[model samples]
Each structure stands twice: as C-alpha cells, then as structure tokens.
Target chain A: MIILNQSKLNPSNIQPSEITSREVFENRRHFLKAAGFGLAAGSALLLSKQSQAAIAPVTFKANSRQKISGFSKTAYGAGEKLTQYEDVTTYNNYYEFGTGKSDPAIQATLFKPRPWTISIEGQVKKAKTISIEDLLKLAPLEERIYRMRCVEAWSMVIPWVGLPLASLVKWAEPTGNAKYIEFISESDPQSMPGVRSPILDWPYTEGLRMDEATNPLTLLAVGLYGEYLPNQNGAPVRLVTPWKYGFKGGKAIVKIRFVEKMPLTTWYKAGPSEYGFYANVNPNVDHPRWTQSSEKPIGAGLFGGRIKTKMFNGYSEQVAHMYTGMDLNRNF
Target chain B: MKKQHIVFVKAAIWLFALLPLARLIWLGVNDNLGANPIEFIEHSTGTWALVFLLITLGMTPIRLLTGQVWQIQLRRVLGLFMFFYACLHIITYVWLDFVFMWDELLIDVAKHPRILVGFAAFLLAIPLAATSNSYMIKRLKTNWKKLHQAVYLIAILAVVHFWMLVKKDLTEPIYYAVVLIVLLGIRVYFKYKPLSKSKVIKAM
Candidate 1:
C-alpha cells in the first residue's frame, strides 16, 4: 500500500529560517540586532564615561531650564535611550503657541505658566481649586521614564518627573455618578496664538474612563529630565499616559472635571474618525493618515530605523488589564 | 536676451536651485536640523520637490501669457531641476526614513492612499526624466509631447500626496494645489479660447 503523498517535509517548501528551532531563530535575529547596537553604543559609552556627569540641561531659551529637586527615580524605561534634552524641549505639539513643532519652543517663551490653579469640579463631592504649589505637595514626586508615543507616528522616551494621576484621583474623591475624568488645557488667546483661530473649539479638553484615570501608569507629570517642565513641554503641569498616545496627555491643564458622560476631546473634535476617546497605543488600530504599526524614535538620529510599535506602547503588563474585552479598533 | 545675459540667468537659476540643498547640508553639519533631523530632512526635501514642480509648470504659462520665448528656453532646465529634487526627496524616504523596508512599505502603501499616490507620482516622473534628452525627443517626435503630458498628472499627484499627509493644517498644501490649479487652468483657457471663436465664425 503505497501512499500517494507521504507526510514528509517538502525540501522546496522548507525555508532556511524554518529549518531552525523557533527559539533559536528568534534568538539569532535578536543577537544580530544587539550586536549592531553594541558596536554603535561602544563609542557612546566611551564618550559618556569621560563626563560621568548628569545629562546637561538643554533648553531652547537661555533661562528656561530649572532643576526640580527631590524626585525619586524608578527603573521604568531605564533600558531605553532618552530622547535628547534639546528635542524634548524644542520639538513639541502644544498647539497653543502654533502648529509647527518648533513653534511652541519659540512662542511659549513669554507665556506664563505660574500661579496656576486646577479647578476640580463637576460630580466631585466638593469642587476644589488646587494651586501648583499645593498640587506638588499632595504626593511625592517620582521619575517615571515612559515611552511617549505620539499619534503622529513618532515617539520619545521621556523621564517624566511627577506624581501619578491616581494620587489626584484619590484626592478628588469623585461621586458615584462620576464615570469619566475630563482635562481642560489652558486657552489663553493673549498668549496662545492657536486658540485665537477656531482650532478645535479651543480650551482643549481630554478625557479618560474612571478606571484609566486611576491606573498606576497614568501620571500627572510636572517636569521631565530632572528639571521643571519646559514651557514648551507642558510647563507647570500636564498629563502623561504611557499606554495612550501623547495627545491623550493634555498640556498646560487648567481644569479637571468629574463627569458621568465622556467629554469631547480636542483631537476627536478636530477629526472624529482619526482620534477617539480610547486613543490607547494599539498598533493593530491604524490611524487613517499615519501608520501605527511602527513609530520613528525622535532622538534615534537620521538613519535610525522605525521600531515596531507595541500594544499599549509596551505597558501591557500594567495597563492591558484596563483595556480587557474592549474593541480597540473601533474605540481607536 | 544676449548670450551672456542668458548664460548669467541660467547660472543664477542653478545657484538658486542648489541653495536649499546647500543650506540643508550646512545645517546637518552644524547639528541644526532640529530634534528630528530625519523628519526635518524629509519635509525640507519634499517641500523643495513641490516648489520645483510649480516652478517648472510656471514656465509654459509664462511663455503663453507673456509670449516670452526665453522662458521656453529655460523650461527644460527647470523641468530637470524639478525631477532632480523629486529624486532627492524619494531617496530620503527610501534610504533614510524607511531604510529599504520593502515589506513595510508595501503594507504602508496598501493601507495609505497618500503613499500609493505619492509613489505613483514618482514612478510616472521616471519616464519623463528618461525621455527629456534630445535623442529621445528626436526619436519619439509627437509621442514625446504625449509622454510629457504625464507631468500634469504628476503635478496633481504630487500635490495630492502632500495634501493628504497633512494632519489638520492644510494651509501649506493648499498653496501648492492652488498654484497647480492656476497653472493648469491657464493652459485650458489658452487651448480652448481660440477654438470657440473659430466655431462662432463657422456658425456665422
């Protein structure tokens, strides 16, 4: 009884990669990438060794950099290369100043971010106005170096210095009816040129589900790179959600409201289909204009390759549970 | 124009065309290309390519309206410069930005209408570039004129390519699109105006 076709491996169909065990094949690719990076990093390590100093503060303006003391460090994103201090300060998306990447750095120089007060109102037990100083004292500052993936297919690894939004949430003590948290960014027509135009019905607003607001990864970042946040990089205070796209992290926030309904956000208003409430960094859900599959690392220099983007910007361990049983594609 | 004056104008155009690239190189050396040098390079090159396409398109319209044969003489040079900048732009995307990632590029083009149209514009420009020479022009004859018509499509594709990539702000792409419309509009008006009058004469 000769079998017409035996279950033998067809030599023609077998690829060189298929011949190796899955583990070995995967490891080989990893080893090659690591080898290349090792050679590239050799010079960087040598140069860094000579300094042995803290990474110098780089500001677009002369007096912009101010050190923020007493913030404890964390191992989060410790392995990732920090986007250059200059890039973090200069290249920003604070459309308040202007739409150009460098516009915020240049235009926000004289714009004031001090004497700020965040009004926590809506469905909270009691509405309270917390000043910048008072807000700083609520929780001890900590350094969380999270990978900030922008909605525009770009990313930066920022060492954000701030307290978690959970701290703010706990302080707010929302009512049972409070299902969502809304963030309102400053809309100073006098200072912010962008708000003057009918750009997204200004006084930019962002929102998150009550659960998302209290996530451990959700940060109320006040500073970055060991310095008080640069005016262009959301001075005084801003939201930094590692799992979500950068736009979800509103800048120069002035008000936070506890609402039963989801608040209309600036980006979602600007482009409904492109931007959504759950703007979680899901590589599977593609933004209509830009590909979400991979992102260009800002400080990776000119010839750097775009690294494949991860689910929840690689904070799945901490934040994936929050998005369980949800359709990211539709919500995105 | 005097031979010397014509030569001087050509040289001046050459200097002007090279300025953007020279400035980029200087900026790159000085580490002044800003935070995202790759983005800076990509955008700068793309802008220059669109600018040149308009400049090239403007030549025929200038010749038509002003009846200046000199602009016609300069047309080939301008067209070649447009193609040259376009080549540099695509090189930056393929080499520096995308890094020969064909699989990803294929998937990207499939997903994005902008990428596919932009690539189509670049592909169409290749034949125009190859046949711009005197030898090809002599061989193709009237076919040369037909082949060159793709420039109109290329210009449109290039504008759409730039237009679609913009997130919310379309102020820049609008300028390019408007210029293209005017340039193409003038050609349409000039081509049909005389024919309509001739038809009226026949009716009379």
Candidate 2:
C-alpha cells in the first residue's frame, strides 16, 4: 500500500496566484515559447504534452450541407461536462440504422442525408415540401447545451446548435384546428435495414402537443458540438426536446404534420404499457423494466458513476407548467 | 469412461466454463468494457448463464443418442457453471448496478415483470445447485430428479427475461428461444417414445 505525505501536499501552502500562474501554462504555444531558451525545456515539453492529452481538441468532419454560422461559440452551461463528441456520435439508439448502440455509427454512414426535404402538411395554412437549405435560412441557429435522458436510464449533455422548433411551427402557420404536431422520420427499407425487421412500425413517428411543440426549449437541431450533426446522430435535422426522454426526439425528420388529435408514436404504439405518449423524464415515475431515479452518463468510464435523475431531467422549472394539474403518474 | 478421459474432460470443461469470467477480468483491467461496464458485465454473465443452461439441457439428449453415461458427469459440471454465472449476474446487478440499494431494488423487482422472472429463476436454481453433490443426490434419490427438473422452467424464465430486457430487435432472444425449443423438443420426443413402445408391447 502507498501512503501520501499529506503535510507536504497541503492546500494551505499553495498560493492562489501560483495556481493561476500554473493555469497560464495550459496554452501550449506560451509554454513552448517561454521554455525555448531555458534548461526547463524538457519538463515544459512534458507538461505541455500532458495538458494537450487532457484537452485534446475534438475533430468533426465538415459537411457540405451545413451552412448555419455564427452559432458555434455560444456556451450553454459550464457546470455539466459535455459528453465526448465521439460518444455522442458513436453510441446512439437510432433504430432506423440498427438496434445496437454502435450499429448506427456503422450503418448510418450509407444513409443519404443531403438533398433531403421535409414536408410540412396537415392543418397548416402553408403546406410545402421545403429543401434543407431553405429550412436553414428560416431562422438563425443557437448553441444550447441540453441534458438528454434516454428511457434506458442513460443520459448525456450535448451541445446542440439549432433553431427553436417554435420558429418552424410559427412559419408553418398552423390552422386553429391543429392540436398536435407529429414528426415522422425517414424510413426506406433499402437504406434503413433495421426498418426491414418489424422492430417498430416503419417511419418512426413522434408527436408533441401544439403548445409543447412551440415551447422555446424545443429545438430542431441541425448540428452538434460546433459541427454538422453526424449521420448517426440524425444528420441534417432532428428534434431536441430537452425535458422529455431521448426517443421523443425524432431523428432525420422527413415530415411534420399538424393534427387535431394526438398522433400515434412508434414506441408508445409498440408497448404502451412501457413507453407512454408523454415520455417526460420523471424520476418519481419508473419505466416498466427499469427505475428512472438515476442515470449512468455515457462516456463516463466503467466506474464513472451515476447521478440522481431529476424530474423533467432538471428542466422542471421550464416545462413543469405544461403538465400542471395533470397526474404525471397516470400520464407516465 | 476411463479415469484419464474423465480427468481430461473435467479439465476441458473447467477451462471452457471459466473463459467468460477470465475475458471479463481482462476487459475490466484493459478499460475495454465500453460505456456501461456494469451493464456489459451483467449482460455477459446473464448470457453465459443461459448458454450454460442450454448446454446442460443438451447433454442428456446427446447422452441418450450416443449411449454414453459419462455425459451425465458433464451435465452436473455444466449445471454448476450455469448456477455460478447466474450468481455472478445477480451479484453484478445488486452490488454494482444498484449499489446495494435494497429499497430501490425491491421496488424495481416489484415493478418490472422481467426482473421478477429473472429473480425467480435464480431462486429456483439455488436448490438444484445445492443438491448437485453426490451426498445430496444419494440422500434425495428419486426426489432429486424432480427437484432438478425445475431447470426446464428456469430456461423458459431466462429466455423471457432476456426478451423483455431488450427495447427492440428480438433477433438475439428469438435465437435463444429456437435453441431452447429444439432442446426441449428432443427431450420430449425421447421421453414419450419408450413409454409408447412399452405400452404397445404390453397391449400385445
């Protein structure tokens, strides 16, 4: 067993300015230039290498389809560490690609996300099939770091760059009769092999109440981590409802329909007993197979540990009013 | 069977049975168990448990077909491995996954049918594992056969537990189900055939 000399490593002996000065060496160029003429060059190089390894810059492949700019530098929060871009893209549950967590990253490479069109129809005053470019021009995108909680009791903090869903809903000019907005995902069996199997009904569908759809927190994400969304992560565009479970965020959206009644969601239709239409992240309410009280954050290594799940995934302040007076247990 | 052959077979079975546990340790030490290691460990142990259960079930049919009584010795070894893996699976869930939060675990078991079924199957395997030794086998005699027959029921419950655990894509579960059905079918066919033949002979 190894024991540390606690007296020598005491925090009281460390000066605040010394700590701040040490942080200044975080810049590799500064460290290199300062050490260029000194005998401390070797140790400086070693320190720089160590720091560089700790904060290795993530590289995102550029997509020609992505054009939204001026939204990359925005930081949503400093508290929660963002789930690694690699994990965010590679570990996914986009069933259209495949059911395995890693399958989407592999199979979705063949998926054609560009030249995509989303048809806005059903009870909308302006019903049109718009190209992705035209949709991008509709509104300016902003980076929002949101906590995504999956029903499987895993969670991630993703920095998503997107326009608010409310802007798109407003542009559609829904008729007075529209009560719900249904989002449909692309599902060509030739492309999405997972669709061939009856794992879920083809053309995965998800819906939100009109009020929920127009909520400021609801985003139509086009990019993640200052880059175009990876094919595995819904590519060109996808829904991002921070308060609800991840499945509610329909991937690779193909169609948006304004309806007078609640739409049949894929998971809810598959197993209503397990997946309810309103999949709000409620810690008090447990899933049929697992408890929702806690979540293991992905990319947080083997024993990276778990945190207590919050109601509405810690967005209760923003979304709790939407379900006021309604029994969450019953809705769940 | 020759004493040497029995020793060789036992050594091979031991290595084969311990492979999954060894692989898990390697993966854990190498930090290659992926995002959710607890889940990975749980799933790996559970699957091995089911695989061993199926292998144990298959032994009887193979013995019947080949007229090898030595296969019966292998069956006990395989059954013990099945129980061992099942214990690991449960221990992983209780100690690592839930962190010994008994209240939450109890609530989860009560709420989830799959967890309840899996726990029940593990509970049933306890008696069989305990009586696998020669001492208990001789003590119980005919009743031991009846007690160990619960493995068939355990197999069904294990399959259902796996089926319910997955969110979608029943391909893996379906494969397990098919293997189990074939094994059970073979046992049923052999079991009734001798009875029917004896009945015909008695009638004549």
Candidate 3:
C-alpha cells in the first residue's frame, strides 16, 4: 500500500516546470493559431512576446466547420470532466487518416468531409441518399456528454452534439426484415492515406443489432463541442454508441444499410478471434492483448491515476436491458 | 582498429545510448509527452530497450561477417544499456501504470499473454545483466558463453512480446521481427553450412 499510494503524490509539485501541465494541451492550439495570426495579420504581431496579445487567448479559427447553434445540454456524464478539446480532436483512431493517434489531426487536414451524402440501401423502404443537411434536421441536436472507452484501455468524456440514432432509423424507414444496421465510412485514397494501406479493409464498416441501433442512447453525432465534426473526427456525420468501444462507431459514415444477417465489422474481420461484433465496454471481458478492467483517462496529465471502467461504460441502465439473456462475454 | 579508437567508439556509443533517456526527460520537462504520459514513457523506454537489444545482437554478426573483433567488445556495455531501459519499462508498468497494485500486476503477468511474455523477457535479462561484468565472465569460464546465449531467447521473446501487444497495424513490430529473423538467420547459415577452409579461416 505504501508504494501504491505514490499516485496520490503530486508530480507537478515536485517539478512545476518539468511536469505535464493541462495548459499544454489547451494552449497548443492557441500557439498554432498565434503563429498563423502572426503571419496573416502581418509582421507587426511578431514584434515581441507581448505582441501575442494581438491574438486573443481564445480565437476560434474561422475554418469552414460550422457550429451547432441550439444544442441543449443533457445530464448524461454532465458531472464527468470533459477531455480537453485539443486532446479529443488531436488524439483519435480514425484509421482512414492513418494508424497513429495523432495522424488524423495532421493527415486529415485536407480531407473534404462536406458535400457528403449517406446512402441508405438494402431493406429500407425509402432507399435514397440523404444529404448532411437533412440528417441534422431529423431531430433537434442534443449535447450528450458520453464516456467513450477505447478497446486500447483509454477513455474520454466527450460532449457530442447530434440527434438520436433512433430518429435516423425512423427516418430511414427500415423494413420489418431489417435485423441489423451497418454503417460504412467513405474511402477516398487520394485524401485518406490509410485507405491506401491494407490495414483494415477499406470503407471501414461497423454494425449494431436492430434494438441497439434504435436505442435512445445511441446517436448519429454530426458535431461535438458545439462545432461541426473536425475532419479527423469523422466530420459531417458519424455514429456514437457510448456503451460500446469507440471503434464500434464508424467514422465519416457515407452509407447505412438495413440487413437481415449480422454485418461484418472492420475490426471483426481484422481479428475475428479478438474483436467480436458486439464490442460492448465490458470490464469483465478482457481484450486479448490488454485489460479492460481499468482505463487511463485521456487528458488526465502525467500523474493521472487509472479509473475503473464501469459496466457498459456506465450506460448499463439504458443499454443493459437490450442484452438481457444474451451472453455478452460470448458475443464479445 | 587502434586501442584508443576503440575507447573513443565506446564513449560515443555511451553518449548516443543515453540520448533516448535524455529525450524522455526533455519531453517530460516540456510537457510534450502527449495526453497520456504513461503510455508515451512506456513506449519510448520499451522501444529503446528493443533497439539496444537488437544492436547488441548485431555486434556478434558484425564480427562473423566482417571479422571486426572491436565491435564485439562493445557488446557488454550495449547489453547493460538494454537492461537499463528494460528495467525502466518494467518499473513504469508496475509503478506508474498499475500504481504498484500487486494483484493487478500479478494478474497482468499471469493472465495476459503479452504481459507474461514481456515479463519473461525482463526476467531472463536479469541473469545476463548480472554476468555482464569481467569478474563473473572470468569465474564462469566456458559456462559464461553458454549462459549468455540466453540472449537469443530473450531477443525472440522481446520481439514476440511486441508482436502480441499491438492491436492492429502490425507494421512496426513486423520490422523488428524481420530484423531479428535476419540476425538469427545469419548465425544459422554460418553454423550449418559446409565450410570452405579459406572461408572458415577468415570467419574465425
């Protein structure tokens, strides 16, 4: 216990200058913006350190990404601390951009997530292409603060702004034969470097059972932190299943299909033995390579302690009933 | 090579070997270790350990292929450096990553094959690191050669441990595996091949 309690010691206090500061993640983007501002606003801003004041501490880069105007905050994970916007945006696993955690932020800079239309096919009644505009209009956007646990034993709290996936399913008008919903991400080799590599089969696919797809807890997130999705974070539109691992949500989705049989997901096909179709965040069921019993909180700084992962990522009340009588360990 | 040149080369290797540790400290000081500092440290130290171990294994191959005896003399220091980083990696995993939770650490070593394999590599390294001194090397005699050969197993375990840890995109680990295979392949080819008198004399 003596050594175990070492986590309680504040590393920052030992060496304030050397320790990882939360301000680093927060101020990194500001410094990038300041550098750009110094160039764009002319050499006057670069006169001295004080000249950085020309760029405010919080200058939202006027990129084309739109902001969601009227998203109402929800009680879901409201008490939890949101991961830093920089960390959430920069540290990602969208393999379409690349394999590295920071690859998407750098590599997806030129990726055009707009002009996107999700194609609905298979057993849907109204099988048609719906633009990003109509997708948002399906329902009022809600700012749902959800805990997303990655299978790699890391987790983040994100304030995702989007409509319930149930609304989109209702809009799709799936036929009675629809048993599972498969989400497909767009794969353009010219923009996405990872698509060129044979990492996972391109056009990354993920699926959810019929009940899970239409659950109120599930979301078709288009924006996060009040802004339209960053290109790296599956911009324009993507799926968000809080109860499952992050990879369960297909990023930058371009198609949704209503199918009878279970849809083969990218992860499921990649490692059939390790990744199961239903990748619910079950702490009891450990991943083949790593443990799921505990997860490191992203943006918790250097001396951060591990947090015990909750069942179904703490959305068990809303999601557990769906898995009733179904063995998640086997399904997982 | 001249005696003074060998000394200079060993000093240079020492400087170069210490850089990765210095870089970790620099990153810690600058807060550049990213969102998860534990992961960054673990990977940096673990990767450096593998890099040093591979280089140590390459020293004997250098002597075998080119008859450069000077290079093999640096193996002891290089092996010691590998042990240093491996120790750091294990400490980070047990203390910082698991917070010295004995049950979790035991479970990690006992349950997960990746952790178990990695732990085995570290345990095997201890005996070799202990015998990396002149006193033990002199006392152990012919047995020293036999005992230190455990590095071959340790190297394979290190690569296998890395191969299993990755979730997807096995590109990085595959490179290390390929290098290890080639290094071992050379020894096997030299050992079993029908030896020409002149070639054998040159290799010796």
Candidate 4:
C-alpha cells in the first residue's frame, strides 16, 4: 500500500485554461439539474477543481499478491498504470472503437482524446456541456475490482478506476420530471467498424432508470487496470453498472440526456425478444440459445465447466430494493 | 475390381469422413476451442453436415443433367456422412451444453422457435440415414422412396436454422440457401416437366 501526498498534487496544474469554452461544462450542469443534487458531498466532487482546490495524490496498490483464476494481479493505477501486453488489455469490447472486444484497443489508438467533450441536454433544467479534462478533475480516482459478465456467458473481473454515477448525478441535479438518463456514444462509422453493421443502430444508446443512477453501484468508469481504458474497452470514459450485463454498461459514451421516460437501447431495439432493455444479470433469465445459469470465467481453462450465477450478480444488498417485488423471470 | 484397390478406396473414404470428428476430439483434448467450445463444436459439425447434405442432394440433379450414372452410387455415402456429422453435432449440444438437463432442454425447445425447427430437421435426417443400408432399403423398397422424401424437408429446415442463428452476418447462410434452392428446383422441375415423344425412352 502506497500512501498519497495530497500536498504535492494540485488541480491548478491539471485544469485546462477554460472548461466551459467547449460544450462539456454545459453537459455536466445539464445533468446536475436533471438528477437534482441528491447528496451534496458527492455532488461537490463534480463541481470545478477550485471547489477542493487541493489535489489528492493517488495511492498506488500493488496487486502482486492478487490472483484472479489464471491471471496475475498487477498494479492498475486509476488512470495511468495499465498492463498492455497485446494478448491482455488490448483485446476487449470498447464499442466506441468497435463492437469486437479487441477492435477498440487496436484501432482506437488513432483517436485524439484531448478535445473530447460531452453534450448534456434534453429534459434538464440547466443544459451545459463540459470538457473531459475538467470532468476528471472533479473527482480523485480510486480503484474497485468488479466482475463483468457479458451476455455471451463469459465473465471477467476488472479493476476499474473512476467515481460513482451518483456523484455525477448529484452534480447534474435531476429535475423532478426527469425519469431516466439516456447515454449515447459518438456515431462515426468510419472510426467504429461495428456501427457499420446493421445489427444495431449506428450510435449505440443505453439508459438507466432515475432510481438506478442514484444507486451507489452505478459507476462512471474513466479507466481500467490502472491506466486509461484501452480503446477496445471504451476508452476515455464509459459507464459500469456492476449488477447488470456488460452491454448495459455503455462504452465510449458521448451524450447524456435526461428524459421523462425510459430511453430505447440499441440491443433491445435490434431484437426485443432476445435482448430486453432491463438486461439484469439473472440466472433464471436464459438467453434464447444458451442458458444463463452458469458462466465460464475468463482466464480459466477453456474446457472447465461453468460456475453457477448468483442473483443480481451478488449485489443484492444494494440493488434488491429496486426490484423489490417484481418477478425477475418475467422482467428478464 | 481388385480386392486390394477396393479395400484401399474404402479406407480412404472412411478416413476422410472421420477427419472432422478427429479434429473436434483434438481440440477438445488440447482445450483450444475458445470460451464457448460447445457452441463452436456444435456449429462446426452442423455446418459440415449441411455441406454433405447439399453434396448428396446435388448428385441426383448432376447425374440427370450430365448423363453420369456413376455419381448416383456416391450419393449414399455422402448422405451417410451427413448423418454421421449431424449425430456428433446433436450429441455435443445435449451432452455438453444441456448436460442432460432434459426438463430445461424441453423448456428451451418450447421457448425458442429456432430450436424447434432445428430439432425437426434432425429428426427427419435420422430415417433417411437409417434406410441408406441395403438391408433397410430392401425390406422397405416401396416405402424407401417415400421415406427419402424427408431429405427435401430437412434441407429446407436446415436453411431456416442457419438464417435464424446468425444475427447480422448472412454470407455463410446465404451461400447454403442458394445451393439448396438450385438442387431443390431441379428436382421439382424433373418431376413435373412434360416429356416429348422423341425424348421419352422406350422400355425394353
């Protein structure tokens, strides 16, 4: 465990000359108004760097003693430390770069991230855009190792670095009428090969019900494995909802629209019967072709039998209240 | 034909048919088939079975159009190979994917429309393969022709199965559909077309 020196790190050095010159500042403000500052402290994390003023130096946790099935635990700094051996982090699903998991890591290297800004509008009372640089400065990064389960029945435990979605939601300040938040990725077919296919709408879209976004489990993941997320895994930034399937965690997110009703998701739109928008990871809810009772853990032997899936991906304490009396089988 | 030549040719054909089965066994042993090996194995065997089915179906039309009588005999071998691969495919899915989860399998077959179609195709292929042997053919000579009619139904169902499984990539399934359509079209035309007096062969 490495201790951080908060005295040495300052936001004055990291903050860009102007955060509102681009549209991202407006986006954050728009989201704040829509979500309606639920918790003041977390919301403060989303305001300008001047709020804290003093930067907290990052505390590094060496994963030398960590073991995940067949993989070795390595230090993954919140936004800087990453393991990039071609066979590892580079091969993944960062849908903004492409649909194939490995495509984003391989092709997203061509993307210039310095000018990135997100547009937040729709039903929000305060609509404003903000730059990506200012967004990172709002919160100090920390790591959490979470299990990611794909619809295809494979699982991976990733060390994600970012802030909770609640924090951003608080800053966005949801209005009384805002019922859901719709996330959209940039739609540039020339850069994203997966969008070229008619399988899903060109610009991928996902949504979280208003209550879900307020859940602490919802994360605004900026990086993984101690380094900036590889292009294949939603580089720059993405959302990670631990209780849901991987696809529900939209990658390479560009737009955040708070609306009065639930947003239409790409997968659900492509085949409604096959991919339900709720996309909760439930063992009882089987895929059309395959059963969801078990999952083949990634990094395990290819021939190994799958392990049984737990309810709500083992986050029943935090999320079970949301589903309270609903039948997961029917909702699934 | 010389006995040695016949033995060698028979061995070669048997070996050729077993090649895919051997490859599956090798991959299963080495654990190299990837995350969802059951799906991969099931798909590989099912694809090869379709290829063989298409080949067997083509022999009749090809022989009729080209006046090649020798090709008709190979049809039996090709049909049997198709059944052989199909058995491997189904067994893999049942034994590995479902793991003898009969109740769950039943529910799956009931819920998924595509599974029902695939199951129907698999059932139809069974009788056609069972009657391929000389003993079964001789015992049911009059009925053999009627039973073999199931192949046409199986071919159609197989194409439907392929089309439904693919999400967006249609290239491979489209290729199979095209071949099946041509083979099926020729059969239908031959059966229904009117023959002229000059073209009709006189029976001795």
Best by TM-score: 3
Stretches of candidate 1 exceeding 4 Å from the true structure: A1-63, B194-204
Over B67-172, each residue of candidate 3 has an lDDT whose tens digit, in order, gives 7687888999999999999999998998788887776667668879988999999999999999889999999999999999999999999999999988778999
Q: What C-alpha lDDT values do all the predictions have?
A: 0.81, 0.81, 0.83, 0.69
DockQ of each candidate, alpha-carbon based: 0.50, 0.55, 0.50, 0.13
User: Where does the lowest 10-residue lDDT sum fall in candidate 2 chain A?
Assistant: A49-58
Task: State residue A187's C-alpha deviation in candidate 4, in Å.
Answer: 2.1
Question: RMSD in angstroms, candidate 3?
Answer: 9.0
On DockQ, the leading prediction is: 2
Who is ahead in DockQ, 1 or 4?
1
Task: Categorize the docking of model 3.
Answer: medium
Candidate 4 regions with alpha-carbon error over 4 angstroms: A1-115, A298-302, A325-331, B1-19, B22-31, B197-204
Ranking by lDDT: 3, 2, 1, 4
Chain A only: TM-score per candidate: 0.81, 0.80, 0.81, 0.73
Give me the displacement of residue A166 in model 2, in angstroms: 1.1
How well does candidate 2 score on lDDT at residue A2? Answer: 10
Query: Per-residue lDDT tens digits of candidate 2, residues A128-212?
Result: 9988777776776677889999999889888887888998898999999999999999998887888888889989999999989
In candidate 1, position B52 carries an lDDT of 84
Give the per-residue lDDT digits (tens) of candidate 4, residues A48-97.
Answer: 34233232222212111111101112233223322212223544655555
- Candidate 3 runs further than 4 Å off: A1-65, B198-204
